[model samples]
Structure formats: C-alpha cells, structure tokens
Target chain A: MRRLKALIKKEFHQIVRDPSSVMIAFILPLILLFLFGYGVSLDANRIDIGIVMQDNSPQVQSLIRAFENTSFLNAQVERDRREIEKQLVAGKLRGMVVIPTDFTRRLINPDDTAKLQVIADGSEPNTANFVQNYIRQTWVNWLLQSGLSEAMLTVDERVSIQPRFWFNPELESSHFLLSGSIAIIMTLIGTLLTSLVISREWERGTMEAMMATPVNIIEIILGKLIPYFVLGMSSMVICTIISIVVFGVPFRGSFITLAAVSAIFLITALQQGLLISTVAKNQFLASQMAFISGFLPAFILSGFVFEIKSMPAFVQAITYIVPAKYFVSCLQTLFLAGDIYSVIIPNVIGIMILGSVLFIVITRKTRKRLI
Target chain B: MLNRIKNLVIKEFLAIWRDKKSRVILIVPPMLQLFIFSFAATLEVKNVPIAVFNRDTGRESWELVQRFEGSPYFTDIHYIYSDKAVKEYINSQKALMVIQINDDFSSRINSGQQAEIQLILDGRKTNVSQILAGYVNGIIDRYNRDIKPEAQVRRSSQNAIRKGKLTASPFLSPASRSEIVPRNWFNENLDYIWFTVPGIVGILTMLISLIITSLSVAREREFGTFDQLLVSPLESTEILIGKTVPAFIIGMLEGTFFIIAGIVFFNLPHEGSFLHLYFGMSVFLLAIIGIGLLISSVSKTQQQAILGAFAFMTPTIILSGYATPIENMPLWLQEFTVINPLKHFLIIIKGVLLKNVPFDVVLEHTIPIAVFAVISLSVSTRMFKQRLE
Candidate 1:
C-alpha cells in the first residue's frame, strides 16, 4: 500500500508537471465546448427573407402577419422574384416568398385555391426547406380562417399536420450539450492520460525499472490509474460546473446517481486506456489505439450524434460497446430532467455492467505481463 | 559532395522502407483515416428523436400519434402516458420533441372548431431542434388546414362553442417555417461537411506522419543505432534530409488516400487544379515533418520524442478548424494558427475540394505553408548540428 501510494504520487506529479496533460485535460475541452456552444448552432434565427406580395390586401396583410409571428424570419420586400434571386448574390437573403395576386380573392370564393411562391436559397437546403414550409403554413392558416368551408377540403388542405413537441419545453440546445461535454471530457482525459502514462513508461524503459522493483504488476497498474482517475473526476466536475453554473443549464438528476454512473464510466475509460497501452507498449501506438478506440467511439457511437434508435440495426448493435452512450443518457437525464428514474436505472446498471467487463479485460491484460 | 549526399539519402530511405510494420504504419492508417473521415464528417443533423404523448385515448388522438410516428422528420419511439409524462420525457431528454393532443381535440375538430396541440421540443441541440421544430410546425399547420372549412361558412355557429385556452380561433393562425427565409447561419451553403472533412484530413496527416517523424531519431537512439549514423561523414543537413523525405512521403501518401476517398465516397469536388493541391500539400507536409524533426533533435529517448510531439498536438489541433471554426477563436489564437501548417492546409484543401475556388485564392494560405516549411526546416537542420556538439 505504501509503494502504491508513492507510485500514485509520482503519477500525479508526472501529470501535473507535464504541461500537455493540463492543456488536453482541461483547456482543450473548455475551448471546444465554448466554440461549439456559440458557433456550431443548428437553430436559425434573425433570418432575412425577401418577399413579394403581388396583392396588397388586408387578407394578404393577415397572411403576412403570420410571417411576422415566427421569430425565425422577418421579410424584406424585393422588387420581384428575380430581385430576390439577385439579393441572394448580394448576400441579402437566404430565401424569398411570393404572394400571388389572387391570394386574398381565392379564400373569399368557395372553390378558388391560392398559391404561394417560395424561392429558397438552395445553398442551405435544410434551413431553406424550413423557411418555405413556414410560409406555406401561414398561408394555409389564413385560408382556414377567412370564412372557407370547415371541410372545404382543397387537395393541399385535406391531409394537414399538427405537431406537438414533448419533454424539452423550450428546446434549449445548451442543456443537452453541456451534459454531454462532461462525458467527452472525462473519456478524453481518462483514456488519454492512462495511455500516456503506461506507454511513456514502456517507451522510456521505466516499466522495466518499476518491474525490477518489488512492486507487482497490479500495483503498477492501479497506481498509474488512481491519479488519472482523480484527475478525470475533477475534469468532469469542472465541466459540469461550467455547463450547469456558467452556462446556466439546469441540473435535474440526483447527485448520487451522477456520482455512481460517472464512477463507472471513468473506471472503464481508464482501464481501456491501460489495456491499450499494455498491447501497444509504445507511446505512439498507445495514443493511436486510445484515440481510435476511445475518442472516435465517444463521438460517433455514443448517443451524441445520430440517435441509436434511428441508426441501422447493426450500428445500434455496435454502439453497445461504446461506454459514452450510457453516459450521455445519464448525463442528459441528470442535467435536464431532475429525477428520471425510468431512464436512469437502466443506464446506470448498463454502465456498471460494461465497466465490470472492461475491468476484467484490463486485469487479464495485466495478469501475466509486467514488462 | 552530391554523391555523398545521395548515398546518405538512399540509405535512410532503405532503413525506413525495410521495416514491415513501420512501412505499414506509415502507409495504412492514412488510408483508413481518409475512409473514416469521409463517412463521419457530416455536420447536418440526420435523424432526431422526439417524444409522442397522447391524452385523448381515442381514435383521433391515435391517428394524430400515427402521423407523427410515421413521419420521417421525427423518430417517434417510446410513447409517454400523459402531459406530465411528456414533460418528464423532455426533461429527461429521452425525447427531443413532444406532440400532445388535449382531451377535447377530436371533439373540438368535429364540432367545427380547431384545437391547438402543444409541441414541446427538447432544445438541447439548438440548430437541430430549431430545424426539427420547423418540420413539426409545418406538419401540424397542415393538420389544422384539413378541418378548416368545417368551421368557416357552414359551421360558424358551432365554432362559437370553441374553448378559450386550447381553442384555435379564426384570427389566430400560428405561423410556422412554412415561409422562405435566409440560409447559412454559420457557413453559407458551402455544405458543412466540405468544411469539416478538409480539417479532419489535415489532422489525419498531422497525426500519422508527425508520430513517425517524432520517433524516428529517438527510436534509433533508444535501440542504440543512432551512433552509427552519427559517426558517418554525413553532415547534419544530410541527416536531416535522410529523415525528412520519408516523413514527407508518408504525409503526402496519406493525403492521396483522402483525395481518392473524397472522390469515390463523398463525391467531393475539386475546383482548382490538382497540381496546386499537390504543391500546397507538399509544402504543408514539409513544415509539419520539419516540426517532427525539430522534436527528434532534442528528444533523447523514445518517450520524450512521443510526449514532445503530443504536447504540441492538442494545441495544434485546437488551433486548426476541426472542432471549432477558426473565425470564432480569439485573435491571439488566430495568430497562433498562422504558424500551424494544418490551419493553412485545411483552408487550401477546402478551397480546392469544396468551393472549387481558384488557385489564386488558395495561394493566400499556400504561401504560409511554404514559409513555415522553409523556416522550420532551416531551424531544425541548424539545431541538428548543435545537438551533435
């Protein structure tokens, strides 16, 4: 135990002394999170829309009122559809809406149907698609309200859609993002620090030096991991505070639940790094294995991108191997929703189960091979 | 002098090329990185999961739920029991969006008044949720339109009986992204993957070749073979040459794999001449390989070599526009990126590959790659002799 303590202290000193660990574990994650939070937004707001209203009637004004209602767009009148296209080059707007002259008259008559012309900036298909859809909805609502038959049933009118969202009341992206960053940062530090520790020792022949000492292989592995495990935990806490306190994301889950789940994830991450370092026995290969196995898996397979439910069956099957998946679920539940027992229990147990199996694998890798 | 230089270069190349694992290491991972990055570099949100809450417990509610479930825009799995359940689902982030129908929904629609259904979307992923909310609003607006005329002329008297809070009055038409709006909130139509992949390609090249370069001298020293090279009449410049060629080749070869992958897999385009890209990449690789050589000169052991390289990598990568846009970075960081070859190379790659921009525009960045190469290469060789002393 005394030898292990010395070794653990050495590991912590090495981690603190090496300026690189400080940068990767703490600095890089924060910068990445802040950058992603501010810049990589999927939500479109304050959009400039070019509009042509051929008919300037009160009815058309009401239809235009719908455009004013959605915070997403404020329409600027262009001379014609051609001018709207011209403005796309001038960088004036992403899309243009055209209200046909017959729009107000059509809703007044029983059978007359009105057409709205939407010219979307084809460059960004997603946002443009949404923009055009919004104008169509506004037009439809106007027609429904202006004394048409309740069952007038135009071809475009019959099969209508009403959407209601649940859970995320306001749909704040920061809440989920802040939660997920905790897992990514922890995974990064856990795998990266351990791989560096063992692999550096192997590269420097220090592993041989330690093995020549009375310390057992178990002692060596545990000693190396203990410091990093603490650092990883601290980094996770730092990130949680940033996301919750600094970023103002709400925390909803129980602290015990978070502690339990996070413990399992960190253990699994550290061990996987150690196990890779054992096989690689070299710094370059160790880091490569850790990154290819740890970081990539966390980014892709972890419920971070492309929902597991939506992925192909085979991909979903493969994601079970990624520890970050369960962590993300737990993190989201904890940060966004106060007590999600229904989701938390299974995820926590799953993490523990995965963590146990990984620990076993790490032990087997260390069982015979001290050098 | 030239013959002596040629001999040293040939011998160093032979040493690097002969090791099977090392040769495979230099060649294979780049190819793999190219393959992985092509598939994984997309920023566009593909599939979003939403929660569905149905309270009416009747046919109308069921049909409404089916529409949401069937819609491709939403992955409607795992239904919640009540309004509170939907709120819980959103709070837990188990559902990104919720579509709920009030108890009087169907009855109100039948009686010639429309019911306002509530859609609470989980907004954790701001851009994706916003895009998704637009999709939901579009579909729901259509649903409202279907029952329009029933309340219009014929059922005006029936419409008068509509409830206050949940009722959709004739005057209140909720506007959804059923309109035309501006595009490109971040990177105007340059397809976000086009921006991301080039940066990833730069990182992949840096990661593989830099690792090899950093370890080459240290590996020789660790194995006690570096003394032989030291005793040979080869000047430090010649020795540096011996080290650099293979590293440059390894980096270039990796870029080739990504180029091929881009063409075949992503249908990535090239706007500029292939020659310019080749030239730019060669210089960029030279600078980065020079950086690896500089580390090799100082690092006394393999562990030092690896750690030295890594200590540089995180900042190098962050400064590059892989995880974040460079424009958003602080001015100091932006200036720091000027020296990072990956940063210039990323711009060059994107300009040529994605935007199909002309060579002149790309030249702004290519100049930096060349300058960095010459500077680092000169400094490393000068430092090489100091190390020998």
Candidate 2:
C-alpha cells in the first residue's frame, strides 16, 4: 500500500512537470469546446441562392418578394439563366430559382399551369435538400397569402400540421452538439493521457529500472491509472462547466450520475490506451494507434453529428463497439431529456462490459519483468 | 549531394516499412476507415423509429398511417393508445416523434373541415428531428393534395382581377396553379455516398501524412538519434527533404487508392480529368506535410508531436466544410477557413469529381494551397536551420 502511494505521487509529479500533459488535460479541451460550440454548425442557415427573374410582371414580383423575406435564403437576382447556372456550377450558389416569362400569362389563364424551375447543386445533398424545401415553403406561403388558394377550396378543407419540437423548441443544434462534444473531449483526454504513459517509460528505458524496484506491476498500473483518471475526470468537469455556463446548455441530470458515467467511460478509454502502450511499447506507435483507433472512431461512429440509425447495417453494428456511442447517448439524454434511466441504464451497462474486457486484456498484456 | 539525399530518403522509407507494427498501421487502418467513413459517416436520415397516437377510427387516418409506413424515411412505427404512452416513447428515446390525431380527425376531413394533427418531435436530436419534420410535412401535404383535388387550382386570377388585368372567373382548372419543378444537377438522385467519399479521401490523406511527417523529427529527438543525424554528412535541407518525401509519397499513394476505391466500390463518378485531381492532391500533400513538419520541429517529444498533430487535426477537419457546408458558418468563421488547406482541397476535389471543373478553376483553388505550402515550408525550414545552428 505504501509503495502504491509513492508510485502514485511520482505519477502525479510527472504529470505536473510535463507541459504537454497539462495542455492535453486542460488547454486542448477548451479549444475543442469553443470550436465545436461556435465554429461548426449543422444548421443550414443563410444559404446563398440565385433568383433569375425572366418575368418582370407584378405578380411574379410578389413571389420574388416572398423569397427575399425569408431569413434562410440570401437571394441574388440575375437577368439570365445562363449566368445563374454558371454560379451554381462554380459552387458559388447552392440553388437557383428561374421565373419563366410566361408565369404571369399562366396565372391569368386557367388552362396552363405555371412552373417555377428550381435547380440545386446536388454535390452537397443536405444543402440541396434544404434549398428545395425552403423554396417550396416560400412558394406555398406566397400562394396562401395572395388569396390564390382560397379560389380553389375553403380553408377548412386543408389539414394543418402543428409541429411541436419537444425538449428543444427552437431546434438549436448547438445544444445537442455541445453535449455530444463532451464525449469526444473525454475520449481525447482519456486515451491520449494514458497512451503515452506506459510506452513513454519503455521508450525512455525507465520501465526496466522501475521493474527492478520493490513495487509490483499492479502497483505501477494502479499508480499510473489513478492520477490520469483524476486528470480525465477534472477535464470532464471543466468541459461540463463550459458547456453549461458559457454555452448555456441545460444540464438536467444529476451531477452524481454525470460523474459516475464519465468515470466508467474514462476507465474504458484509459484501459484501451494502456493496452496499446503495453503491446506496442513505443510512444510513437502507441500514439498513432490511439489516434486511429480511438479519436477518429469516436468522432465518426459515435453518432455525435451523424445519426447512427441512418448508417448502413454493418456500420450500425460496428457502432455498438465504439464506447463513445454509449457516452453520447447518455450525454444527450442527461443534458436535454434529463435522467431517464431507461436510456441511461442500458448505455452504462454497455460501457461497463467494454471496460471490463479492456481491463482483462490489459492485465494479460502486462508482465512483471521487462521483455 | 543528390546521392546523399537519395540515401536519406531510402533510409526514411525503410525505417517506416521495416517495422511490422508501422507496416500494419500504415495500410490496414486507412482501408478500414475508408469503408467505415464511406458507409457510416452519412447525413442522410433513414429508418427512423417513431410512434403514432391515433384516436380517430376513420379510413383517412389509417391511410395517413399507411403512407408513413410506406415511407423509406421511417421503418419502425409504434402504435400508441394513450397520450402517456407518447410521453414514455419520446422520453425513453424509443421514438424520435409521435404523430397525434384527435378523435375528430377523420370526421372533420370527411366533412371538408380543416383538421389539425400535432407532431411531437424529440428536439434533442436537432438535425434528425428537423428532417423528420420535413418528411412528415411532405406526407401530409401530399395527402391534402390527393384528398382535395379542387384545392390545387390557383386563385391568382383574383389577384389579376384586383389589378384590373382580367375579369373575375369563378372556376379555373387545376393547371393554372404555380408549382416548383426542382432539378438537382450534378447528382440527379443526390447520392450521399458520392458526396462523402471524396471528402473522406481528403481527411484520411491529411491524417496519415500529418502523422508520418509530424512524428519524423520528434521520434528521432525522443530516441536521441536527431543528434547523430546532425553530426552526419547530410545538410539540414537534405534531412528535411528526406522527411518530406516519404510522407508525400505515402499521402499520394493513399489518395490514389481511396479515389480508385471510391470509383470502383462506391461507383463515384469521375467527371473531370485525373490530371487535375493528381495536381490538386500533390499541392494538398505539400501543404499538409509543411504543417506536419512545422509541428514536428516545434515539439520536443513524440508525445508533444502527437498532441500537436491532434490539436491541428481536429479543428482542420471541423473547419474544412467536410461534414457541413462552409457557407452555413458565421462570416468571420468562414473567413477564418481560408487558412485551412483541406477547405481549398475539398473544393478542388469535389469540383473535379462532381462538376467537371475547368483547369483554371482548379488552379484558382490550388493557389491557396500553394501559398499555404510555401509559407509553412519556409517557416519550418527557417526553424530547422535555427535548430541546426
């Protein structure tokens, strides 16, 4: 027990002395939180589209005016379709609306249906969908306001859909994205902190010297694990505070539950990192392995930004192995939907199972003597 | 001098290739990530689980429910009997949304009276919820149009009559309605895979090359071999070249492999010339290597170098307009993305693959990458020289 205490103290001193560890523990999370909270957005707002007004009729002018009134679209009027098409091809425009010259004539004549041509740059499917939906909405609003729809049928004949967005009324994406980023930040700190720990000792020839001492392998592992576990937990706390105070993301779940789940996840990440370091025994290889296996998977497969349900079946099955997926699920619920254990309990169980497997692998990989 | 540089480059490549671990690291993870990213990293929403709370026993409500069941967007539909069940489904995250129809739904629609249906969405999943809302609106819109065929006629003639352009007509045909004919160019069906595969190529290339070059100097420094290299006959410039060459070669090779994989496996369309694609990739690699080497030179240890790379990479990927559009970002943040090389390269590659962009236009985007490469390389070179002295 005394030896374990001494080893932990030494580990703590090493972390305090190393500037890089400090940067990873504190500074990197700050930058990542700010970047994700402000810089990256899934909300498709202020999309630039071209409006080619081939018709100068007053009736067409109201449709153009309706397009102009929308905050979502930045409409640039052009006289020629060819010019707008060039902009669309150049990737300058997301979509373009072309008003035909016969639009007013079609409106006056009951026999002909007036068509507004909407061409979207389909290289970006999300933006293209947004552009199409936004234009369709604008046109529908124009028709309803112009009393054009009243002539066809009475208002009672229509079915109105009242969409109520629960939990997030404004549909602010940053609320959930900020919560999800906490899982990412924890993954970075946890994996990166321990990935270099054991391998760094081996690379610097200190592991051999440590092996000759009175302490056993368990003492060393525990010593290394405890300090970095505290470090990872503190990083989590700092990130949560920033998310709640600076970004104003509501945290409805109990603080105890948050800490408990974060601890389990940090253990899994640290165990995975420790396993890599033990097997590779080289700092460079361990860090690279940690990055490829840890960070990228956490970013893509965790369903942080992308929906896991939308992915292919094989990919969706793979997400079950990604620890971040469970953490993100827990975080989104804890922060937005509160402490609903129906969601949290199963995710916590998944993380614990993965963590136990990693722990078993790490213990098997570690030996008392230097190889 | 040429012989010495060639020897150094060969040594660098062998140093990476000779190690079985590094060999596995270089080839296997990238291919795995390519498949995972191309297949998994998609924004297209599908197979959403939702709950429907219908109180009306009318045929119209059942038809609307059937329409939702037929939609490709939703596959898992839970039919709930009570309002409390709706709360439980959304709270437990068993469903993304609940469609509620009051007892008067079918009766009102049959009587030609306006009926309201409430769609309660779980707003926690912001993007998915909004998209699902759009899908729901579309279903209802089509149902509304199908049921009330007379509503398709436009009353724009009333506006015309108000403007004194024509006399009032009581009845007009359905053909007089103004409709939007949407055509998505480049990708007519808007396949999400084609969009993501090109961007994944950029991301994986950046990651591999950045790790390789960024660790080159730091690895030597950590193992105390950098001092031996400085004592050797090779100049600092030659050593830098040796480090840059392997990373560049590996990056280009990986880029080519992924691009070909995209073409063969994903059936990604290659509209523009391969010349333009390779030209843009080479410049992109140069910029990435410069940034990596800069990190390598500044970092004292391999750990620092890795952290440096991580710090640089996360923001680069986020800001590159890969997952999201750059235009959607704030004006100031959008301006900041100009310094990000991936942002420029993505445009060039996407333009080449999708738009068949002209060479001059490719050059237009490549100019930024070239400028970035020149600046980063010179700064790192100056730093390398200072360290050598």
Find the candidate with the highest DockQ and give its number: 2
- Minimum summed lDDT over a 10-residue window in model 1 chain A is located at A149-158
TM-score of each: 0.75, 0.96
Per-residue CA lDDT of candidate 2, range B131-227, in tens? Answer: 9988998888678766764433334335545665435454542325677789999999999998999999999999899999999899999889999
Candidate 2 residue B178 C-alpha distance from true site, Å: 2.1
Q: What lDDT does each candidate get? A: 0.67, 0.88
Residue B86 in model 1: shift from native, Å? 3.3
Docking class of 2: medium
- Relative to the real complex, the DockQ score for model 1 comes to 0.19
lDDT of 1 by residue, A185-286 (tens): 788777877887787788778888988999988798889888888887777778877777777888867787788788888988888888878888776667
Where does model 1 exceed 4 Å of error?
Answer: A10-172, A368-371, B1-51, B57-63, B75-80, B83-94, B123-128, B150-202, B214-232, B266-272, B290-355, B364-389
Give residue B32's error in model 1 in angstroms.
5.0
In candidate 2, which residue pairs get closer than 3 Å at backbone N, Cα or C atoms, i.e. clash? A113-B175, A148-B155, A156-B114
Task: For model 1, state the Cα shift of residue B359 in Å.
Answer: 3.5
Task: Give the Cα error of residue B146 in candidate 1, in Å.
Answer: 4.2
DockQ scores for all predicted structures: 0.19, 0.64
